[model samples]
Target: MTTKRILLYAALAAGAFISVFPYLLVVLTAFKTKAQLNSTEPWLPGVPPTLDNLGRLLGGDFPQYILNTVIMTVLLTLGQLVFTTFAAYAFARLRFRGRDVLFWLYMATMMVPSAVTMIPLFLIMRELDLVNTWYGLLAPYILGTPYGIFLMRQFFKGLPAGLEEAARIDGAGPLTVLVRILLPLCRPALGTLTIITVISSWNSFLWPLIITSGDATKVVTVAIAALKVGIGVDYNLMMAGGLIALAPMVAVFVFFQKYIVRSVVLTGLK
Candidate 1:
């Protein structure tokens, strides 16, 4: 290889290592024993690795935490898909008066950080006595977000109008066109939104932490945070929790990353 190309590859490799090394350290540390983790040795685990940390977790309530996280993520993603798609279809296709103004007004909510709304939401949930229930945990999120609606709406607006027009000519209703014709073609956009929602919902810590009490309703993120308690940290256990919390998102990104690219490409085309 040319010297310039060699330098480029070297720089890229270095940057990759910088980006990945912390996660690599977490993975390595999870497999290490308590004694090994306490030692000065920075990266490598001693002699044999151990499953004791992970085993301890899986042997107990961590699986429940995993389940809670899964339940929330799945429900949240599905709700976002249904609600965002419908709202986007309306904003994109329907010609109701004040549609643009209404959408922009709704979208303005995005400018407000979620932290600002949490107190009011909590108070409302408290007033309704919904706190700590599944409804309480999910009700705030299941309607989806302005960003998702905006993304879906932009994608919907980009499609060739002829397809929907042709479907209309065939006596297809709007819902029929949305479900059978338009949605299928929107696979890339939907997939993009699904993955985004799944990742965000899965990693959500603050809302779940604030809303949930006890082990029952706490998701994996809260569970992981619970590892570092009081004065000291249990590195072995904490690292293991970190690994467990991270795996699903990594798998999700690896699998659905293509859809993100496709959405970008398709949207850019319009």
Candidate 2:
């Protein structure tokens, strides 16, 4: 091989190792005992791998945290897909008075940092008496995001108008065209949106932290933070919790990463 090509391959290999090393350390540390974790070489494999940390995690409120996270992620993702799909279809295919202006106005919200809206949203949830409920935890996200709407709209716009026109000629209404025609063809975009929404909701900490109290509504991210108690950091336990929290996201990326790449390519989303 050419020297340039060899250098490129070496650079890629170095980048991959650098990206994966921290996660590898976390996984390895999860198996270590407390003593091993406190040692200078905590990144080394445990002398004898132990399930004690995993057992304690599972036996504690962690399972509930997992369940809560799953429920919130699934519901929020589904809600976003449904809401954004309809909004995108409208924005893409349907002509309305001031449609472009309105869509642009809505999309402009994306420029606002989420942190800026958190306080107002919290107050709104509080006004509705949803402060400590799962609904409150999910309210901000269950509604579609500007980015999701934009992504779906771009994908929808790329689709041939003839598909919807043909469906309409067969007496299919707008809803029918969306459900039976557009949605089926937009699987890659849908999958991409689903993965994004799931990951975002799963990793959400600040919103859940502000809206929830105690263990009742705590998601895994918040629950994992709870692992740090007044006592010194239990590195092994913390690593174990981190692994548990990370496993689903890793599984999801492994499964849907192809769809994400395909969607980005097809939709021309950078």
Clashing pairs in 1: none
Which candidate's TM-score is highest? 2
- TM-score, one value per model: 0.94, 0.94
* Candidate 1 TM-score to native: 0.94
Cα RMSD of all models vs. native, in order, equals 1.8, 1.6
Off by over 4 Å in 1: 263-270
* Top candidate when judged by lDDT against the true structure: 1
lDDT of 2 by residue, 1-270 (tens): 999999999999999999999999889988988787766484579778899999999998899889988888889988999998999999999999999999999999999999999999999999999998988988787879999999999889889999999999999999999999989999888888887788888999999989999677889989888889996888788889999999988997787788767766755653
lDDT of 1 by residue, 1-270 (tens): 899999999999999999999998888888988788777375786558889999998898999999999999999999999999999999999999999999999999999999999999999999998888889999998997998999899989889999999999999999999999999999888877887788899999888988888788989989988888899888888889999998987886687677767756755654
Q: Least lDDT summed over 10 consecutive residues: which range in candidate 2?
A: 261-270
- Candidate 2, residue 60: CA error in Å? 0.9
